[model samples]
Target chain A: GGIITQTPKFLIGQEGQKLTLKCQQNFNHDTMYWYRQDSGKGLRLIYYSITENDLQKGDLSEGYDASREKKSSFSLTVTSAQKNEMAVFLCASSIWDNYAEQFFGPGTRLTVL
Target chain B: GDQVEQSPSALSLHEGTSSALRCNFTTTTRSVQWFRQNSRGSLINLFYLASGTKENGRLKSAFDSKELYSTLHIRDAQLEDSGTYFCAAGNNAGAKLTFGGGTRLTVRP
Candidate 1:
């Protein structure tokens, strides 16, 4: 049994502001991922880390950046916020690189004013 | 880029009813996984299939590697089953998963 904790269940930001989201997992998983979900849309990959200090860009990584400072934690940063932007940021971790099941965080809902 | 598509973007069913959700892949995939998003915004893994079908309780899933598709079936629906369901395919080249738009399901009393 393991837990994936995401800080700040809700976040609010102003246009052009930078926002950061944090995720930590005690599973000691080797892979971590960041995904963004817009209203009425599917989840899009933003970033993924195979191991500590390793970063890979996803389809939606143009305006986002990610860091895996340690094996247990991964963070996502929004370079600039868009007005009225509302979405949920989801973090997931997997124990293996194969099509293994991923454990997800509770998620952080973000609103850009 | 690899692609995934879910059928019936939204669904509603009465208690005791049965339904199936499908995910189609644009390319041959290494594996597939199913998930259900709860009201609290937590994605819970329902099934992980490398190939063939697997069942647990009222849920069943099947993955076709060559055909590039997956299916999830729910029997005797319950209110607690209401929410969005997603299926993601893992690519063999790098093991990166590409997710579908998801299916929003509602089970009514």
Candidate 2:
């Protein structure tokens, strides 16, 4: 069994600051995803990568950028933090198969002050 | 756009009781996944199904692609089971999972 690791379990940044979250997976999955979950709500996908150097925008990708330089790692950058924003960013990975289950990391909680 | 709608935004159950949560899809879904978010904010994958039903211990899940719905049943609930559950639907391979609003389940003794 492989695990997904996300850095900086908690983050605090100023308004308009750029914060980056990193994720790495050893499952060798071909697909990686970034999702944001607001308090008391479900997750909304921000970006996903199907392969190395490939990216796909999701419903909530407007304020975020993603990079997938290595097959085992994916990173997300908050282009500009919004004031008083609080959310948890989750990273997940899965194989290319339609039936494959996506495994998630512990998540990074971000707070913009 | 494809959407996943989960019913009963919140639920309460007693120990040893049984309950079920459901998800209804707006479009044809090729697969469905169920996850439970623990208190520490970690998502635990419970079930992944393309079709039919699957049982593991006290939890059972069913997915009907033709019917565009899925259900998760919990038998003999426990305190550890109190958490937020989410169901995600996918139409294509390797990308784009539409998640439901989530069902918060609290198992009280």
Candidate 3:
């Protein structure tokens, strides 16, 4: 079985700082996704990539930028972090099928001070 | 707007008890997926159903595309099952998934 790995299990950033989170998958999946989860809320999609160098915005992509430089890796950048913001960012990968299940990595917890 | 709504935002169950979680979609969806998020914030995929029912271990999940709803049943719950459970729906032939608010399950011994 393949695994999805996310870097920096915890992150602490100052206001207006730009923080980047990285994800890597060994599943050789064709689709990768970025999602944000706040306390007491559901996961909201930020961005997704169908292939290398392809990007698509999601419902919550206004303050985030994503890059898929290679097929096995996807990265998300938080542009100008909001003060007192606390959330967990998750990375997931799935095969290119309508019924394929998306596997997720252990999230990166972001805390802005 | 296409949405997924989950019932019983929070639930508490004693070990060995059984319960069910429900997800209702605002529109017709192609498929549904269930995930369990552990305390450390890792999401583990449980089930992905296009239709009918699927069972794995002590968990059983059913999806009715015609009714725009899904259900997840846990039998003889264990303490290790304490976590947040979420259901996501896919409307089209893409990778986008709309997630429900999640049901927080606390299984106490």
Candidate 4:
């Protein structure tokens, strides 16, 4: 069984600061996704990639930028952190089709001060 | 306008009890997936159903595209079953999923 690993389990950022979160998967899946989850709420998709160097925007993609540098890694960048914001960012990977189950990372908790 | 409506925001159960969680989709969904997020915030995939029902161990899940609903049933609950459960639906083959609000389950001894 392959695992998805996310860097920086916790993050603290100031207003207007830029922060980046990274994800890696060894499942050799062709699809990767980024999602945001607020406290006590469901997850909203931000971006997804079908293949290396390919990107697609999701419902919550406006405030974020994503990069699929290669097949095994996907990264998300918060352009400008919002003040007093708190959320968790999750990464997932799937095997080239929607019918397959997606495996997720533990998540990175972001706190903006 | 959320695409998925999940019921029972929270639940508490004894170790030997049983219960079920559900998700209703607002649109036509091509597939449904169930996941349980543990205390450490790691999501573990439970089931992925395009249609019909699937069972594994003490858990069973069913999805009906025509009915636009899905259910996950857990019998003989254990302390390890305490976690937040979420159901996600996808309308197309794009692999983008709309997640339910989640049901936080607390199993007590």
Clash count, one per candidate: 0, 0, 0, 0
**Cα lDDT of model 3 by residue, B65-93, tens digit:** 99899999999999999999999998873
lDDT of 2 at B40: 92
Model 2 residue pairs with clashes: none
Instruction: Tell me the TM-score of chain B in each candidate.
Output: 0.95, 0.95, 0.96, 0.97
lDDT of 2 by residue, B1-109 (tens): 5389998999999999999999999888989999999999999999999899999999999999988999999999999999999999988634777889999999999
Clashes of 4: 0
After superposition, the stretches of candidate 2 with alpha carbons farther than 4 Å from their true spots are: none
**lDDT (Cα, tens digit) per residue for candidate 3, span A43-99:** 988999988989999989999999998999999999999999999999999987755
Q: What is the DockQ of candidate 1?
A: 0.67
In model 4, how large is the Cα lDDT of residue B11? 95
| Top candidate when judged by lDDT against the true structure | 4
Off by over 4 Å in 1: none
> Of 3 and 4, which scores higher on TM-score?
4
Ranking of all candidate structures by their DockQ, best first: 4, 3, 2, 1
DockQ, model 3, C-alpha based: 0.75
Q: Kindly report which residue stretches of model 4 are placed more than 4 angstroms away from their true locations once superposed.
A: none
TM per candidate comes to 0.95, 0.97, 0.97, 0.97
Q: Score the docking of each candidate (DockQ).
A: 0.67, 0.69, 0.75, 0.80
Distance from true location, Cα of A94 in model 2, Å? 0.7
Over B30-67, each residue of candidate 1 has an lDDT whose tens digit, in order, gives 88889898888788989988899999999999998888
